[model samples]
Target: MEPGTARIAVDLLGGDDAPAVVVDGALRAMRADPDLHLLLVGPTEVADALIAALDPAERARITVRPVRSAVGMADHPSAARSESTVRAAVTAVRDGTADALVSAGATGATVTAAVLGLGRWPEIRQPALVATLPAVAGPVVLLDVGGSLEPRPATLARHAVLGAAYAAVAHSVVAPRVGLLSVGTEAGKGDRVRRATDPLLAVEPLPCGARYVGLVEGYDVALGARADVVVTDGFTGNVLLKAIEGAYAMAGGPPVGGGAPRAAALLGVAGTVVVCHGSARADDVASGIALAAHLWRRRATELVSALLDGDAATDRTDRSTDTEVRTS
Candidate 1:
């Protein structure tokens, strides 16, 4: 293997179009990165097909961890069993067999497995799933895409720090401007959660010299004119991300840079993990694997967590005052 090789464990049966899409994506990723190694976590037959397609020399870089069970999209997070493919991929990271993992499985199941197998960082009750969008102005890092569906004000505050650190460490964004997603830029324009979360973010000590830019609108997220890192509960972020992708599809193609990514990096977990959309295509799966390798090489997860430790007050979020916001 080349120096700094990133061995990524890929869940072969994770996506809506499994085995076939995954195999094709893995082939593309391996061909693109000379140093990339893969541990195919799925059925032996499925893994064999991929290996058979590769040249003998290239086949040496691949390993198979035969796991037949997979978590369906309709299944609950609790369905993440030790024998399942996603859980096995997490185990590879936890056991040092793989540097990171990529899964196009159920987001909740992947998050659950990562938390159960690798454990969460200190004081992170809800691990955020952060996605980077290549906007016209620059890269926009949005968090809680599908990790915590209904986070409290304190959780949103915590994720603000996570987004800031991720933007700086992973994307080389300096002094990231953080913002809470709201219906309007005006203060208190959103629901009770947005109004409550606004002040917490303003007072919260952000890492990487990040500053809270207060509330931002949907336009800010798409154009990247207002903030570098946008924080929101998982439900809204997830909905918004899909909507952006659909808009791009309707527009004939994405922008010159690219459109919304089908994959996101899971923060607050101890190991590097990339979660792709369940309906991910071959290119999306390839992008997810590439993201995993990139994160492992940068040691993004470790550095981001260390940044969190610098601010002792980040963990002091008083969740007792948190109330559920009505989405209706």
Candidate 2:
């Protein structure tokens, strides 16, 4: 829609419904994005079915990668499967055949494949999965949805930086307000990790003119009344995200703004990747593919990496100055 070519690799066998929903989603994405080219990664037959349904004009934008193997949601993520479709999708991004990849597979498998295939950004130990939720004020960026289940204090601080940069670049959030997700807005609330990370985030110089807003409650994530980016451990963040989605469903659809996204963008990886919920519907899969395209087009991944490098350099200079003064 933004008028650029975005070639995305889609895993045809990654979701609960396998090739059916994946194929349907691919069709929707292709139709919605005239400039989008998709490398359908799955069995030849499934890709053929999708090709048959597309018009000649749409068909010209498609290419099939023909992967026959996949590890289901129930399968072990660390299992020695050499030819999983998710892995092949990553390969496409790494090889420049695709600008990005979208998969509704096991989060663990997707994260592992991306890290192993594309590598991680420097100083990023535990890459995060970030989800953007529509809030009353604007879109709120929440991170560590499932990437690192139990990240350390430093990891949480790093995610704050990533989320701030992402919100500014991808969502146009200016002077983004960052907060640590906790039980209360108080300083010493929440678990040990949140407590430890609060001070670190307060001192960490965020890019894009962002500043820390201290600890914020779960309501802040939905209302956007306090922070634009909320950072937390993946275990807590994942649980909270699902709970919010369930609440939205029970209310008989989402609010006027928008609903919780069924997909998350993986940060700290060198390439653009999106992971949908494993039980994603066709629409969900389509949304994931679209998100991946948007990120690739915006060059969000590369821009965020550059910001982090600049921040790191500043820290080193400040530390060097302090050391010189202490010795003087």
Candidate 3:
């Protein structure tokens, strides 16, 4: 949608019904965005079929990077083979052949490939996966959907900062109110991690004019009345996200605006990467490609990193002043 050319590398063998689903999604994405250029990473035949589906005018927008292997859903992320399609796509972004990448691969494999290829931001022990849900109020940003399953309390606090910055930078949320996901809205309502994370978020220096809103219930995630950005550990966030999707399914359809996205942006890594559900449909894959292009065009990754850098500098100065006062 943005007014720039976004060259995206797509992993064709990353989904449950890959190559076919991925090819269809890539075709749909190419037609939707005139300025979108695709670097298809998969078997040569699959890429050829997708490119052949387009007219001559549209065909110029496509390129192919042949990769045969893929990471299966059951494979350990650490076992991601060197020749996997997801890894090739990561290489394309790292090599500047593509501005971003989208994959319906195993979330762990995608994250692992992106981190190893592009490197993570400083002090980011674990990168987070952020999803934007179209809530009743507006868009609600949720982080750690499936990045680090057993994150420490400190990681949750750090993710609060990431979520807040992402809401403002990516979604244009003003003065984003951030919340720690818990059983209730009370100050100390969750398990050990939430209890520890609440105090940290209360004092953390959030970027993009954001503020902490204490604990928020599960309903707040869909309603968006209590917070614009919700933070939690990856395991809980992943489960909650899937449950919300299931609820929308049981109800006939999603609410007016949209539902929980099948695609999530991987934060803390250096490159712009989108990870879709392993069971993604063609439209879901298309949306993932579009999301990657949107982030690249907006320079969302760079801007978010800059916000974190500013916060870090301010924190260092504050600490220095405190030490000076004590010594004086």
Candidate 4:
């Protein structure tokens, strides 16, 4: 762990098993990193239970944000109840009481909470959920895992930029090769959206010395011989991620190098946020927490945001010149 203290706000009521599983994950994380601090946002009793289990010294590193019933009520709805806890967690980050956030709740709810609390980056209409898969070559960055299920071609192109910058900034990959996820490696091989996005990505300026490699097939994602970053719409990306995870499990275990990861980094937001699979186990949660700490220490979010701004500026200039020439 880095020397700087990283305070993470965890949503105690966000998961299916919640509170219990979250408590276990939090305790594990606290024990793993000495400099880690957790702000548990949920019902007071649940937070207290976790604190009581920890040693006095360890307990001191934990804080609690009590959440009760919200104003709206229909004999106590499930959505409203969970929203209260997630909102409180978001509030902690917004108030600077926490450096980052980790949650295993519904993807849509988490995205909504983060957007409302931290605010989205300028010109990032649809925030992307980026997942890193440990490939034979190295880690492969895949984006739009669950954020913008049916994004436009422009959004797919934007995500390519985001994924490339993230891979370079967060993972320190040099000259990342970006690839559009399609049915085949051919130029015009996928659905209508992929076919349209291919040309756009080919022309889009990527940050961190990144370059577009046209189109890549699903096999290229795990093999990682073709591209370092894979971009696709959320619907396809989500399904593909799960299928890969399932394949790893069926093969007895993930490859020695690494398999598909359960946690993802939320890009296009102002803060470092990680969202784990809703069915995440204790180990998954612990990993998610660690990822957030790493990102916060590296200042990944701010650096990636700067990269996107630079790319956007370049795109604007290129478009303006093209329009001028066509008219003149």
Candidate 5:
């Protein structure tokens, strides 16, 4: 619906339902955004089906790049190294053939592909998956939803900076408040990692006039009365995001604005990529496509990288220790 045109590369065989759900979502996204142009990266037959369903006006906006190989949901993330649909989509973005990309495939596979193809920001050793939740007051940006499950204290501190910049740039929050999610709001309430990251975040200088706001509890994620950006380990952040979504479902529906996002924007990678729920429905895929368009149009990945360019590294103690969470 926005004025600018956004060319999105879609992985047609990425979701749990494969081309069926992906095709349905692509059709919906194409109809919703007049300026949206989709490069369907999957089987020729699937692309043909989508093209057949569209009217002449919509059909003109679509382009198909046929790719037969697809990684399975249970396949190892390294499978992305092969000539799979997801990898091809990544190539499209890296080669400037598409402004952005969307996939509902395995999260690990998608993340792996993006990191391998597009590459990561210089200082960002571990790329993060960022999801924005519409809170009571405004959008609450949460990070490391699934990217680095067992990042060190320094990684948490860095994600705080990334989240702050994203809030200010993506969400337009003024002097965004950044917080570290823990068991309790008190300074030393969480485990060793939280305690380790808390002090580091306190001193980390955030871009876009953002500032750290001490520790916050899980309730603040949805209510958002405390901070605009919540930072945590990928394992914890991933679990927390899902728990909030489950709670919203149990309550019959998401809050007035919307529930947790089914799609998350992958930050730190040098490209605009959106990862959707593996079991994405039609709407979820559409949302992911829409999100990719929005992010690409705003040049979020480039802007976030620019914001981090000038900041000096924090002297975070290497308290990485260890956790049970797995990352690709």
Candidate 6:
């Protein structure tokens, strides 16, 4: 709820429920924050429906960028019909019509659209989808949730730096402890990728006073006793996050303090982006909107980008010295 106005582009046909859920979430966000403005991007009828429902005074705060195509149409429908509303939403951000974007559609679709639209930062081979889980101690940042499915050791190491910077800039965690997700806490545990990543992270420079805490197991994720930032491959992280959500349900409910979070912040992109669980409810959508607002207000994306640039500079210096030694 910063004083400045934040225009968020809502993909009216992006979620599982499309216009209905999108409208509901938009209303909730509008009511909660007076400085928020929305640019609904989807079918004209759907945007009109929402606008018609709002009072005259509030209507001015909202605008519509109609995308006539239906939600789940066939691929390559046509440019007017071919491109998805999600892609259009990304275009809005690129063109500076919107400050951020939020979608609950397919993770792949959103990631693809954002990457193609905003362009990835230098040295970021694969963008990361970062999720912040509420821990008893504080918020724990998890990355590669669905962005990089099979990242190499270098990608994993880069994500660690990204996660660390995000935790500090987004959540204000001082001296965040970062951990590589693995089967055991031992140094040599987990698959080849994890094993290789553990040592790389140990020596990699981290931002915001963050330090690498070696390998951590799944149990550590929930307990939050070991690390404040957990890094892993997108495939494992995605499955693990969903499994924890299911486990919380089986146990009657999430722990009293906080449960598994359904919304995740998409990092490595140049915009303030949030991706909700595809099966998100109205409340989940609301939460995602709020999260997007929070990130934009804090200037989280810009700050994280600066941190990554610093890390890249460090990596370059290290590489130059190694090259010099070899030449000498």
Q: Per-residue alpha-carbon lDDT of model 4 for 1-328, expressed as tens digits?
A: 6778999988877666676788899889999999999998877888899999999999889998877663233245434556777778788888899999998877788899999889999879999999999888889999989999999999998898899889988999998999998888878898899889999998887778788988988998888899999998999889999999999999999998777888899999888898988888888888889999889988999999988776655645576653333222
The local lDDT score (0 to 100) that residue 80 gets in candidate 6 is: 26
Listing every candidate in turn, what is its Cα RMSD in Å to the true structure after a full C-alpha superposition?
Answer: 6.4, 4.4, 4.4, 4.4, 6.5, 4.6
TM-score of each: 0.91, 0.93, 0.93, 0.92, 0.91, 0.91
- What lDDT tens digits, residue by residue, belong to model 3 across residues 56-78? 98999999998645424335342
Cα-based lDDT for every prediction:
0.87, 0.87, 0.87, 0.85, 0.86, 0.83
- Regions of candidate 5 where Cα sits further than 4 Å from its true position: 70-83, 312-328
Q: Where does the lowest 10-residue lDDT sum fall in candidate 3?
A: 73-82
Q: Is candidate 2 or 6 superior in lDDT?
A: 2
On residues 1-328, what C-alpha lDDT tens digit does candidate 5 reach at each position?
3579999999987877767889999999999899999999977877899999999999899999977554233353423422388899999999999999999888888988999999989889999999999998999999989999999999999899889878877787888999999888877999999999998887676777787899999999889999999998889889999999999999999989999999999999999999998888999999999999988878788888877774543233321211111000
Task: Mark the regions of model 1 whose C-alpha exceeds 4 Å error after superposition.
Answer: 1-3, 68-83, 313-328
Q: Residue 311's C-alpha lDDT in candidate 5?
A: 59
What value does the lDDT take at residue 187 in candidate 4? 85
Q: Model 1, residue 324: displacement in angstroms?
A: 36
**What is the Å distance of residue 146 in model 4 from its true position?**
0.8
Off-target runs (Cα >4 Å) in candidate 3 are: 68-83, 316-328
Candidate 2 vs candidate 4: the lDDT winner is: 2
* Counted clashes in each candidate structure: 0, 0, 0, 0, 0, 2
Regions of candidate 6 where Cα sits further than 4 Å from its true position: 71-83, 315-328
Local lDDT at 189 for model 3: 91
lDDT of 2 by residue, 282-303 (tens): 9999999999999988999998
